[model samples]
Every structure is written in C-alpha cells, then in structure tokens.
Target: MAELANCPKCNALFMRGPATVCKDCVKREEEEFQTVYAFVRQRQNRTATVEDIVRGTGVEEHKIREFVRSKRLHPAQFPSLSYGCEKCGADIREGRLCSNCTEEIQNGIQQQDQLNDIQERNKKKDLGNATYYSMKRDKR
Candidate 1:
C-alpha cells in the first residue's frame, strides 16, 4: 500500500509509490532529463563530459551524475563520463569502489579471517587444557 509522505525534492505531501518524488518534482525532473538529453544527443556534444553537459544545459552536476549512475547515460557512448567512488572519491566508470579500494578491502578481510582462525585454534587449545585439568582433579 502507498503511504502519505513528503517528497524529497519539494517536501510536498503525496502518496509515496515507485517514484520517491512527488508528481510535480517528477515532471520537473523529466523536463530536466529532456533538456540534458537533447544537449548530449547532438553529434558534436556526444563525447562531452559531465561538466560540459552541465555547463551547456544548466543542469546540476549531481543530477547528471544521477543519470549516469542509473544507466540512463551509457559510459560507452561518452568515454569521459564517470562517477566518484564511494570510498575514495576517485573517478570510476562502474561499481561502487575503484579497483585499488576494492583490493585493500579484500586484503583487510583476509587478514581479519586469518586472525579469527588463529583465535579459534587458541580457544580450542585452552578448552582442551581446561578439560584435561578438570579430568585429572576428578580422578584424584
């Protein structure tokens, strides 16, 4: 069921559905998309960067980035287009993180797993020692 909520863009109360924004905001965004699309569809502007598109169409940089993120703008069509990595703010064409950050995170996880394994082995050894001592005490 749809719930009454304020639109993130305009803060106007409306029934929340698949679209997060209200109808007015949605309409405005569609207009912006058309303006940006038209500007980029031109032959000379086909290879333009996000900055160029923003400058030409007067659209916000974030809005253009959102389009790229949503796959509305194909990176292959515009080689210069990229989005900032969530971790390091480096430019990346796809995924959440750059390759360097991804490798670092994977290395950290591997180190953590090694430490956990060592701890588990130590815990089992300690438990064995405690059991042996308890058995000896009971025998005495």
Candidate 2:
C-alpha cells in the first residue's frame, strides 16, 4: 500500500511507493544518476572516489554516497569508492560505521552489560542481607 510522504528532494507531498522520493524528484535523480554513472563508467574513471565523481559529474557527494550505500554503485567493483563512517567520519566501503567505531560501540555495550550484571548481583546480595529472623521461639 502506498503511504503519503514528503519528498526528500523538493519537500513536496507524494504517495510513497518503492522509491523514497516523489516522481518529479525521482526523474531528476535518474538524470543525475545517469550523469554520475557515465562519468564513472569510463576506464580511467572506474576507480574514482566519491569526491572525484562529484567533481567530475557535478553531482552532489551525498547523492553519490547514497548510490554507493544503496548498491546502485558497487564499491567492490570500483576501488576507492567509500562513504564516511557515521560516527568517526572515516572512509568505509559498507555499513553506516567503520570497523573501529563498530568495535568500540560493541565494547562499550559489553562493559555496560557487565556493569548491569554487577548491579543486579549487588541488589540480590542486599536483599539477602536485609533478611531478619525472630528469636522469640527460644523463650517458649
């Protein structure tokens, strides 16, 4: 089912379909894509980076990165084609983040989990320590 959405390019209201953008923007984008493709498809241009393509094709870097991320342009086939890591801004071929940032995030999560486990164990111990027993039975 198509949903109503604002086009990302022109901010126009449109029916959402397989594409995230509206029809008009899609047309423009297709032209831009073709321009970029033509520039990169040349033998000497096959290994062009995102910036180089943007300069050569007069296309936006974000759009080129978008194409790369969407697999419209394969990075493996074109070496030096990469986008920035979402966190560290380092060049990366795939995913939102580079390996270093991803590993750092995973390590941080593991540390947090360890801390949570320690806190839980401490809580359980405190509950055990808070227990009290009555000695009145000895008086009987």
Judging by lDDT against the true structure, name the best candidate: 2
TM-score per candidate: 0.88, 0.83
Per-residue error for 123 in candidate 1, Å, reads: 1.8
lDDT of 2 by residue, 1-140 (tens): 99999998799999998989999998999999999989988999998888789889899999898888888988988887887798998888999999999999999999999999999999999998996878766655
Q: Which pairs of residues have clashing backbones in candidate 2?
A: none
- Residue 132 error, candidate 1, Å: 3.7
The per-candidate count of clashes, in order, stands at 0, 0
True-structure lDDT of candidate 2: 0.90
Candidate 1 local lDDT, 59-139, one digit each (tens)? 999998888888888788887788888999888888889999999999999999999999999999998888433343555
Looking at model 1, residue 73 earns an lDDT score of 82
Off by over 4 Å in 1: 131-140
How far residue 91's Cα lies from its native spot in candidate 1, in Å, is 1.1
In the predicted model 1, the residue pairs found to clash are none
